[model samples]
Target: MIDAGSSGSRVHVYRFNYCKEEPQLEEEVLFHMIKPGLSSYKDDPVAAAHSLDDLMTRAVKMVPEELQYCTPIAVKATAGLRLLGKDLSDKILNQVRSHLTENYPFPISANDGIQIMEGSDEGVYAWITVNYLLGKLKPSQRGNSAAIFDLGGASTQIVFEPVFSTPSEKMSDGDHHYRLDYGKGDPYSLYQHSYLGFGLNEARKHIKERMVDQWMDDAIKTGRVYHPCLPANHNETISYTSKATTTTNSQPEPIDIQLIGTGAGATQCRAVIEKLFGKDRPCPTSPCAFDGVYQPPLTDTFKLRDLYVFSYFFDLTQPLGMPLEFSVAEFGALTSHVCDGTADDLLKHVPGAWTSLQSAPDTCLDLTYAYSLLKTGYDMAPERLVKTAQKIGGVETGWCLGASIAMLDGNQLCKA
Candidate 1:
């Protein structure tokens, strides 16, 4: 099967040497990753082709023993495809197809496997992961209302599913959380959706604009020339959060999610939140930690997702690309936030924990500037800033997970 992902294309030969008639496993083994591949295309089809050729060689080399002749290559493309124009996309697809069919003895087509899923695909994946993790926290009915936000490299997502009994009929992934990404891989089960446009960097930029916009409104309302938010009046940097599009889904029941997070950069976001909005209580009350998929009373009918599950990850398609290694384990750590020992806390637990500012110097300045502005202008309570950061961090992660969930929601997984 082909996995066209944000980074590149991955080919998987599922049933290598299995006998079609006997249905017996042979010496042939399954393929997971075909590396050195065309994972990202910045719209250069020629460049992409070069990467694909290198990756194909890598795949051919990875075949173990006698399986090389038996296994059929299921080629797929993912994130990098979106960058190409229609002409280029078609050209690339045709090129890949021809190359595979001409070269591989047991050649596979890209469209033969799962591709082109919907928003719900990812939503289902998010729901499944949420349920799995929540199961660790509590034993309850699987189907219940849960909201999600997912920040991804290519896009962002927000999803809301009301209370319902887990279907006796299950999806193909078998877990529940659906995968949303199309043109390549299968959907995962977990929580909800991944909003595409509003990830961390973009969201942060949006937040900065929003803060200025709000500052103008506040100044107009209060009628003060030296508006608290204005640099002319004050040099304080106010904190801001990435706001989201409101959900319209009715709340059938609270999912009471256990807060499962996936993807890298989540912990970094949590740190940013703590910096801007930690509680000022001298006497320690709650230990320094990130909040779970928290629920706040905002509207009457539907509410936001229970927790944040992802981070504002930069798109891998960019020239510089996403920072740090994005891994499931790293993401798993973010979602596993609790009052007890966690790496985020462990990293910054002691007196020097908060002092670890070596990662991003510019970010430190931004944080400081934002914090000063908010504190001086809005008279924002110290605790409120901490709370806001926690919420923002959660929301950012939640949106990403939500997007991933949507990608996996409506798969023909039962067939799997």
Candidate 2:
């Protein structure tokens, strides 16, 4: 199974036990990832499909050569492809299908093999994966399951079995409720939603656009514009086309602007990023999550249930030597320490913490946004315990495993 995510694409080669009544994940034979997701090659669909060649080669080697012809392979793209619009997404998927059929040894099972997954489905898959690993997927364990919070580049998702009763009217909305039937004793009803423009990268883009608008206005009056979220020594050229401003012909024109950071620590950084959460957006639902999105109150359901946060959340936490499970206060303290230092200071203090210089500039901003998302967006208290990790019990904590499981389960459920 291949997961074409926003930031990257990953392939999971699995060996399952079909002898049992229900297929089990016997072994994850191989796993690999490549940067710049298939969606990055939106303009060139063929190249996007070809990007999987190296990963497919590794997959071929991992599976038994004799069994390769019978093995099923699939590619499911997430928010990245969804953001590309239907025409481009279909073109990319078609290219992937052609490449796999013509070049790969695996069986292309059906017409629906390669497709774009809905945001809610993505969340449900991750939830299934974590619960399956945690021994919570059995029919007897229906009520006991962990809530999943996945933070990606282009989107974020939340999925869990709400403890409180959902109104019949609300449950009728397909986006709010999803039924998962694994051809088992009983099906599971999940509350899930995928919020676009809320992921780490998209949030950064929104925040940067706001900064550019203010900076450009200030630069006209003053000679300089300062960015509080970046390091004091950080200097970079940023280009953006403002929605508030357009050319005389009403077409948006890109403008390149210079940014000089003024070392404004966590407090200021949090203030700037907090604006992107859209807290003041009108809420038709009495209890909304953010930007008037209907979400079951997390106060009662999330607090009582086990919560697992992964993806970018784990990436940011792991580099700081933080525990896999920690409270919001501990997370805040760590972000505070990170905010107090410049890029040089961070490098000097936490040697090898950062993998790239490009990521270093936004360390403070990223950490601050994470903290705010928990506190302001989700209303998580400082002492609420949230588990964050890249893997659980030697298996990657992502949607790929769950996708494989769904595929083996005959793809009857989770059609969305």
Candidate 3:
């Protein structure tokens, strides 16, 4: 299975045992990623489909020659393609289908196998991946599953099985509620939602757009805008194309804006990041996350349940020498320390800080956004503990493994 994500495309090869009622994942044979995701080649769908050539070639070699023909192949594009609008996404998917059909021996699982995935499925599948790897999905482990928070490039998702006090205290009918029956145990009534334009990269873009808008007059006067989230003395250029104009038949015009860093640190940057949550928007539900999205109150529904964060959350925190689990309050403290200190200070105090900053100057901004996302957006308690992991038992974590399991079970159950 190929996860055609916003930032890149990743292929996961797995071998499973069907001795038991539920398939047992024996091992992940190979997990590889190729950069510059299909969405990057918006103007060249052929190039986007071809980007998976190397990864596909590797996958073919991993399977035995006799088994290759029967092995199921699927490509599930995420928020990146959804953002491209239906027309472009459909075109690119068509090319991907042609490329896979003509080049690979593996059979496409279904007619709609090579297509963009729904955001809700993206969240639930990832939830499955984490819980399954942790062994919480087994029949013996019912009611012990953890909630998942995935922060990708173009989107972010939250999924959890809420624990209610009474059988009558049920979730309201809405898009946020999903009933998942994996044929492993009792069906899970999960709370899941995906926020578009809220992933690490897309959030950065949205935040930068707000910064440019707020300081446009200054930019017009000085030819540069001051960005508080960036490191001191940092300089960068970002492009902005209005979402309103993107879907029109005519090509959208993009504006280039240069930024100068102010080194405002975490405290100040958190305030800026919080604004992007759209807290002021009207909420149809009594309690909602930012942008008026419906969500069961985390404090009550998910009390004492383990929480796991993935994607950029793990990628950023692991380099900082963080433990496998830490309180949200501890994360806040770390964010402040990193944001207030300089690269030289980091080199002296934190082992990998300097190198990380050198490669990604937006470290401070990323942390600030993450912290705010947990505290303000999700209303997570500062003292609540959350786990982060890129891999478990030598297998990479995300939506792919769970997606593969769903595919093996049957395509209809995995449908949007």
lDDT (Cα, tens digit) per residue for candidate 1, span 1-416 = 45554544544332312123212222222234444335344455456555555446666776654555544444444333443445666666666666666765543422342232344444454444444334421223323334444444344444443322344533223222433332233332333333333334433444334434445544334422222111111232333222221235633321111111122233343343333322353423222111111211113112322433333322211112212333333323323331122434544533433343233322322333233322321233333311111123122212122232222223222121
Cα lDDT of candidate 3 equals 0.86
Candidates ranked by TM-score, best first? Answer: 3, 2, 1
Candidate closest to the true structure, highest lDDT: 3
**TM-scores for all candidates?**
0.40, 0.91, 0.93
Looking at model 2, residue 242 earns an lDDT score of 66
**Candidate 3 residue spans exceeding 4 A from truth:** 241-253, 342-350, 411-416
| Per-residue lDDT over 136-173 for candidate 3, one digit per residue giving the tens place of the 0 to 100 score | 88778788889999999989999999888888887878
Which regions of candidate 2 fall more than 4 Å away from where they truly are? 165-174, 220-224, 243-245, 342-351, 354-359, 411-416
How much is the lDDT of residue 59 in candidate 2?
94
C-alpha displacement of 198 in model 1, angstroms? 2.6
lDDT (Cα atoms) of all candidates against the true structure: 0.35, 0.81, 0.86
